[model samples]
Target: MSGLLQGIRIVELASWTYVPSAGAALSDWGAEVVKIEDTRGGDPCRYLTIGGLDPAQSRVDANFMMELGNHGKRSIGVDIKSERGRDILRRLIERADVFLTNWLPAALERADLSVERIREFNPNVIVARGSGQGSRGPERDRGGFDAASYLARGAVAYALTPPDAEYPVTQTPAFGDLQGGITLAGGIAAALFHRATTGHAPVVDSSLLSQGVWAMAPDIAAADYYGIDRIPVGNAGTAPNPAVNRYRTRDGRWIQLVFLQADRYWKGFCERIGRPDMATDERFVPLANLVANKETATAELRHTFAERDLADWQKILADEPGVWATLASPKEVLSDPQVVANGYLMTVTDAAGREYRTAAAPVQFDETPPPPRRAPEYGEHTEDILLELGFDWDAIIAAKEAGAVL
Candidate 1:
């Protein structure tokens, strides 16, 4: 990965998605990230079996899940619990610009890798901590996953789930973790700027809970102001503005119109949809009249849209002032013309040399995204990193023999 942050060095001592995600984003921004993995098999996420994917279902049997947060980092296996391993880490930390971790507070204390100890190795290096709950709460020491802290404690489930439903809707896989990762990446970038300006590095922290709160900030604020949890979810047929709802097409596709200012485009929208009569009809002229007869207006609009497929409607309203978009399915979105034209998605090879499509980080530099490389294999860069750290071949061999490194 090469773009901005080209000379930045990040020592990533974390596993799984939450914090590693920040490292991944930093790597995407052209940072030199060195992932320090444990000696056994590296990050445990490398071997995790997801709920629905089966090895036999695919030809490559590769771990795409692990690749999400790891695709551009170099991996070196070291048993940091050992003295020799800790010594090797110190040497790396001494040269690093950022020390990133997702270890729990208690875990840091137990492993003697606390922030105070880390500062002793490099006073000016930034310490970026990613966690599930937070650093100062009563539950700070308690471990948490995104499901526990983000969806549950952060009120996301409550905000999303219907009151009449038996169970709250669960988040799609790693949604919260990925959001947290991107948020943490932004925080680290800000910390870097702060360091450059003040001559002192500030500790950066972000968490799944923080991200969840941020995601629902608008809803939370509305709730606080109105003294209510939320306004009830409205149905398309009952929408106050017919232009602000979705309608089904002939081929069973759905298209949403987002005309917040309904009156401004009401006539043009009706003309484009081959319903000029409705535009002149007194019952549906102004937005207030349309709302008074919403059920009827919705039915007429749905029937008019059903007369044409998505392709026809696309052309009919392609240049209209009204904002409209097709409700694309997961499969349809991949081949969307906008996605292809903008280079939002890309293909990258994995460690096993299998080519797979992955999404680019949201931001771009010079209208270009960083090219991704495969995540390193376990201990793949052990000798190279050791040599870089000024260790002789003999010393490297000795450390391996003593179980300090893989």
Candidate 2:
């Protein structure tokens, strides 16, 4: 594979999308990632059928959620409650360069997989922990979900919802979780570099709440200093500058114009729409008057935009513009020329020989991405990994019989 992290090995002991997505990212960069799951059921995300399909109706192919976060990783199921299973984990960690987990401190202690204990096996390993809130405080042990900790507690949900709306809008699937995972991956990469240079094993910690706050730092920072609340501007027409709003064309397509400095392109904009006289009109003469009389300006602009279809408007305003773009949906983005040219999406083949489009990692190397590997099945590499760890066939059989390693 043509990737930057070809020689790195990561031992991941986390479940669900949040942490697993990080492993997927590492795998994208060519790291050898081994996912450790419980023998009982493995990760619950594997069976998730959120889009109206029952688990029993699923096929032997990759599920949507599983493919999104678990691609390019090997899985090994083991009962960490047993001493033999714990030893197996220790051996993996000892041979790995990085150890990642999402289990809380208490859970890690109970399983004897704490960072301190992990260092006993590999002193130079980077210990990375992903959490819901943080590792400290009274609610440290409390379980944290993306919706509760990241979206609600971190003020994302409140900030995005309109003040007059009856209910908060639902966020995109695993929105916060994916961002947190990316943050954790960057932290782990930095820690690995630090350890390589200084010979000091680093403990990297990342939280969903922290990532959420950071994402909305501009609003949160303003609130802290000026006591201002985040008020969602539901209708762009309500904005003081009507020019910086969305307008619908005759074909029902929208063009969002963000003309912060409206005066700069006033004459050109009026000329582009075949309304040069409107530029000199007394009511719309100066920018100050336009702001004061935004409702009238919005009405006039809406009427002007509605006179033509989106394609006609695009051709008319090809050269005359401050800042504008066609409003695009997610499906439209998939076929966008820029997105395609930049290689933002990739095609992958599943176990059932079905090809599907999947997103590539955010960054690229040599102007292209590595071809993705399919996600491994449950315990797909358990026996092979045990054998590589110096276990004989009989020893592996004994461990499997004891319900330690699967």
Candidate 3:
């Protein structure tokens, strides 16, 4: 089926994992995404992990970059510092429906690619900006990333580790970056839809800090109501709930059993595990009592869980009313039968004839399923794009020789 964004064109002037991932998601939905990279080094991610290898070959073979953010898009190398490059972008913006970037305010001002400038080129273009904090704030100029956003806005410090643990655990990967990307894509889609009906461009502003706050709204709300400082409970839940903790199985795998309504399912769960007598015990009878003695209840649950393997526990809990459980791991999740049945994994071939698989866009449209297209080669279509922009062949060749295009 054709994609919902089949007719949209996006010019992505963003790099790194965050903003690029947003553009990639749009491309997966059949948008014509042209990722503009500098002719000098292209994206820093291309050479980030390829060490002690030929720069030319390794930079071009940025497998991780391709997997994470370049899928289903074309790449164009241009020296945005040069006049010719800026002119090229201006021409492309005239025909583009969306422009995305994660450059800081100062950087955007320096490049003259600010929202006002872009609007001058294409009045109906949706401009989306993803940043660390926001466009205006005391910390607006401060450098922000997933770590800073997590620490500052997500209240991650409160839940960094178990209260009894010696030290806090730092999260790896760019959670803020990923969340910001997803939020940016959604904002852009909304802006585009609005533009389609109103014939007026809109600015979509998103930040890692805002996204982090959104993810922690539940905890924030709880903290507000109880007037109690939320602390790390580790495997236990924030609320006084004993049934939502993680338990270790016989095979050393952890199973997260989340049964919020223990009063409703405790008896059935006990019968399923051949421990029905425990269901009627005074200490474990009422939900409040169980929560009051959570430590003891957790220990008993852990011991019971350790008596069986994960598969056995899964069998016992499968479709059990009010009891929800799952074995956590990305590897296990990717191979899940439900994921496959829903066509969430897509396979695409690159220019090098290598085939790889990637997850499909999360949102599923009833009438339009997105198509996966190969990412573009570095400046592969530079000449063609410049010519289409009304640049003469002589000027294009001059620009190429001037290191303005690769």
Candidate 4:
């Protein structure tokens, strides 16, 4: 069966994970996405090698990072600074249902590719843009990357770091990029839907900073209403809810329990851990008493959990009434039965006939997902695209010779 966005076409003039990853999502949704890059070095992400993996080890033209961001898109190398290149983009925009870019306002102005100019080519086209910050502000023209704009500026870094740590802990790679890209794709989908019903094209804009703030909106709003500085989470002991805590197993593995309804689950939780005496103990019988002696209770639970391995605890707690899960590493998740059953991971083979597993998009339809496709080589479809744009071989050769396209 076809994806939800089978016939939609997207012209993406963006680079790096922050914006191009949205094209990846669209491609997964079966949109025909054509990624336009400069003829020189192409997307800089092509050289990225994660976890110290050698770039030369990659079977595909791009390393895993580039593939993860740009998969299933047609690649065209065009120097937009040139008149002929700009004309090519205009023609592509004319035929496109959506135009996506991450260019700053100054860069857009310099290239004469503003929203108005883009709409001139196709009045009904949806102009979707990704940015580090909003379009208007003191730093509107400043270029943005996910780390600087999203985590740092949006209060995420401040909130995530442990208060007692000597230094702030680092966030995972592309944490904000993936989220921001997904947000942009969702906005684009909403814009398309709006246009389909109202026949009015709207500009869709998404920014990492905005997304970061939105993700923490509840905490920020609560802080504002309380007229106090945000609280720092130094450790499990500092967590507002004692029921929500992590305990170490005898095997050194960690299990996190989050039973919000503490009163309802207190008896069962204590009984399952073979600590029935603690549940009846006057100091811990009532929820308020337990909270008042949180340290003692947590220490006792930790001691109890340390008496058995994770496997033993898993079996003992399986039928107990509480919300809990083992802390799993990425490798563990790769082999997780639930993830496998849901098809959250997929396999793809590169041109060299090498097979590897990759993540599927965070969506499903009719219990199925789109097959993962490898990213294209640089300018892989330039000739075919030029032909589709009504340029014959002679004309295409001339453009290539003139350095307008690759």
lDDT of each: 0.85, 0.84, 0.77, 0.85
Candidate 3 has a TM-score of: 0.90
Instruction: Flag regions of model 4 displaced more than 4 Å.
Output: 50-53, 56-62, 232-238
Q: Candidate 3, residues 136-237: lDDT per residue as tens digits? A: 888776667777775566676565556766666665455567667777888899998888888878888888878877877777777888886673255433
Q: In order, what is each prediction's RMSD in angstroms?
A: 2.2, 2.6, 3.3, 1.9
Point out where model 2 deviates above 4 Å. Answer: 51-60, 231-237, 275-289, 314-322
Q: Per the 3 Å backbone cut-off, how many clashing residue pairs does candidate 2 have? A: 0
Model 1 C-alpha lDDT per residue in residues 50-82, reported as the tens digit of each score:
788786786563566667788788999999999
Clashes of each: 0, 0, 0, 0
Number of the predicted model whose TM-score against the real structure is largest: 4
Task: Give the C-alpha lDDT of model 3.
Answer: 0.77
lDDT comparing candidate 1 with the true structure: 0.85
lDDT of 2 by residue, 1-406 (tens): 4477888999998888888888888888888999998999898887776765675665445676777788888899988889889889889988999998889989988877777788899888898888998888887777787888899988888777765677986787788988998888888888888888989888888888898899888789888888888743644245668888889999999998888888898878988888887788777768898888888888889999999999998898888758999999888988999988877777678666877666766777788676767778888999988998899999999999999988
Total backbone collisions, model 3: 0
Q: Candidate 3: which pairs clash? A: none
